[model samples]
Target: MVLDLITIGWRYTMDFRRPTTTAPAQTPEEAYRQLRSLADESALRNLGALYSMAVDDHDIDTVVAMFAEDGSFTRAGHTVQGHTALRDFYIGMMDRYVTTLHIPNSHVITVDDDTATGILTGQAELSLNGTLMMAAYRYDDRYARQDGRWVFAARTLKFMYVVPIEQMPTSFGDSKRIRWPETPYAEADLPEALPTWDSYKC
Candidate 1:
């Protein structure tokens, strides 16, 4: 259900500024520190891609794999957790659509050693039996390093808008990689984390 509320959106003034993080070492000492930072950045970006690959492959298993064992996905007023909800949600969606495109852009990735956080802004368009619908929102994610791997621990999202098929609006694209846009942006692309995004295996 896409909202009819449309006004060129602006940055939300949140009482909370940035996520709290650990202090980086003052040591300009080793190349390893910089490498670790880069690696962490890479992992954060992968968080976004994992979501894309999960939906694109129609593999809820891959989707759930992106999360920690007790991790949860929250959107709108619904929350899905563990693995069962993960499976059920996607399986249920299959009844209505054959394919979906998850266009993620404006990603904000924050990293520190064994933990990182991300805010992913993007739109998703679903083509159900040839009918098209679009949705726009932000995914505020909390990730942790578990057993030497990065996984989503919590995901909070807020919908900015949606354009349903009933409205005859069609700007959604097909199944492919989504590129980030560059204007009138309510969202911002802070940094990219390729490691987190690349966790999903096709």
Candidate 2:
């Protein structure tokens, strides 16, 4: 009897330390707002997936259509704004690759009414001048609702590594991991470049 009482007392202490509270029921307006937010987030995620599919298929028109009229895309310090510039940029990029496959992963998005932002990490396999290259990359994106649809407002691409598939074994050890054909070796732009990574080192 004494042991049972001790066990019960310990259980009560734990329950008091970690009290549980029931959440208030949502009103109809609150529920509707939540559903809308979920739909927007789903659309925003589809934007990234569709982009990868279009790029791999060389469907430049479809890729460009995913962006807002005034949207901008930036890569390697170059920024192209508006649909015309965006189209030209994508065309030029696609022309360099014989074929490509992009796999997008780990997309995190935040919705704030009609506007949102996201970060996407992905990898790609490209046939550049007959040399197969593997690349790990990330995209920082801003999105807006245009004509009741979510479209990219701006996107910036950054690379963690882009090396010839054959050189993958040794490339990670090299300080300069970006080994695009015909271009000078360049440093990777990722984990090490992240501010949080640096903060932890200190």
Candidate 3:
């Protein structure tokens, strides 16, 4: 009986005291800043994905938009600059190639007050025209923060070699494939624990 009375008294004291709310509420400015930060992060992730898609589709329009006006692509003793130059380069590449697959990795974005810089690594495979050469390359990309947005500032591509030329099968008059090459441009495997679009279950 005494223990029950003591418990009732404690409960009454807790109810009367009213829990002290110590946490400070965010100010209006702080809330806005946090929302903007989230928006910027989303933009960066989407930008990276867009870059991958543009190169894969050989979409010159999208590719040009991804870079700044003076952005440069450097590879094989050549540096292509500006949107017009970029268009010329892409068109020329398409004429000499059937397809290209570009994959970007090791992404790092540094935000500074009003500006940011993004550094990343990328790899590509290009199927050339006329010859059965497979061009394999890796890239180091630099992006700039402009007008509250990020854009590619420069890109440098390094290639080990244009391989698979020796494995080309002889041309035949018919549609049937007679000779199979020992080596082909096999797609690179995704890293372990890679998250696919289907994995989201969205």
TM-score against truth, every candidate: 0.65, 0.85, 0.54
Point out the higher-scoring one by TM-score: 1 or 2.
Answer: 2
Worst 10 residues of 3 by lDDT: 8-17
- The runs of at least 3 residues in candidate 2 whose Cα sits more than 4 Å from the true structure, single-residue gaps closed, are 1-25
The per-candidate count of clashes, in order, stands at 15, 0, 0
* TM-score result, candidate 1: 0.65
Task: For candidate 3, list the clashing residue pairs, or say none.
Answer: none
Off by over 4 Å in 1: 1-31, 165-202
Candidate 1 residue lDDT tens string, 105-144: 8776666678776667888787755656566767777789
Query: Residue 175 lDDT in model 1?
Result: 21
Using lDDT as the yardstick, the better of models 1 and 2 is: 2
Please state every model's RMSD to the true fold in angstroms.
12.3, 13.0, 19.1
Residue lDDT tens for model 2, 1-202: 1111123211101122111323343798877776787799789889999999999999989999999999999787778999999999899989989999999988777778889877788999999998999999988788999889999998888889999999998888776888899999988876665544556556
Local distance difference test, candidate 3: 0.56
Measured by TM-score, the strongest candidate is 2
Q: Which 10-residue window of candidate 1 scores lowest in summed lDDT?
A: 1-10
User: Which consecutive 10 residues in model 2 have the weakest lDDT in total?
Assistant: 9-18
Q: Would you list the C-alpha lDDT of every candidate in the order shown?
A: 0.63, 0.81, 0.56
Error of 2 at 4 (Å): 54
